[model samples]
Target: MTDFAVAIRVYYEDTDFSGVVYHARYLHFFERGRTEALRACGVRHCELLQRAEPLVFAVRKMTVEWLAPARIDDLIEVRTRFVETRGARFLLEQEIRREGRLLARADVEAACMNRDGRPRRLPADVAGRLAARVRDETSRARSTGD
Candidate 1:
């Protein structure tokens, strides 16, 4: 599987009193996917923080759509991809799927920021690698509007 694929199992802690996954948990899965995607491309958050530029990725905005609910014990996959890149900001499209069923999707815009929280341009090498992995995929088996 590509770096975009991250498998996560919903646990008791991820659920609400109803035994259904708490809405906020989906965002956590997406975050992991984004982090792993960068790692697969040879970039790491700690390394970025240690660089001379000393930067971190901060979510500037996010729009999430809930299509279905995932319950505890469900095996889910969070798929992530770069949708666009503009200067210090990049847009990511992510989805939570349970056995090929789309449960939720989100569009996240993140910015590279310095320790002082000032916007900083993404490192050239990092940006290039991210762009190389950029993709927009619609379901072949079922379509969810992008």
Candidate 2:
């Protein structure tokens, strides 16, 4: 499957004392990719907030690897792939790449939650559509062996 990807420029503000991207900034980059991916797939966060349950997706767990550093002015691509979904949870695999080389990788587990902050199922129809899209992509990826 073709992973959802977003190009991000590492600016001066994204760097730390030594001029490399601050470690925590990578999380923001990953979030932006996921947000755009959902938008492209027809789920809008603003609309989600207007639902009866006023729902949102929240990251419950994540693991990240810092393989290399990104410096100011680096053009990084944040790529996201849906791994799976079960009940109120979803898993995404993401990577930060610079010039086709890996800078970092992360696996994130997200849970659907209501305004009250209690775990809840994602809107049924929305989840179904997203799941279908993910399945289609998975099939194509396997067929192409990419």
Taking the candidates one at a time, how many backbone clashes does each contain?
A: 0, 1
Compared with the true structure, what per-residue lDDT tens digits does model 2 show for residues 28-146?
A: 99999989888878889899999877999999999999999999999999988887878898888899999999999999999999988999987787788678767977888888887
**What stretches of model 2 exceed 4 Å from their correct place?**
none
lDDT of 1 at 30: 87
lDDT of 1 by residue, 69-101 (tens): 999999999988776677999888888999999
C-alpha TM-scores of all predictions: 0.89, 0.95
* Model 1 TM-score (2 dp): 0.89
After TM-score superposition, the amount by which residue 114's alpha carbon in candidate 2 deviates from its true location, in angstroms, is 0.4
Candidate 1 total steric clashes: 0
Candidates in order have lDDT scores of 0.85, 0.88
RMSD of each: 3.9, 1.2
Number of the top candidate by TM-score?
2
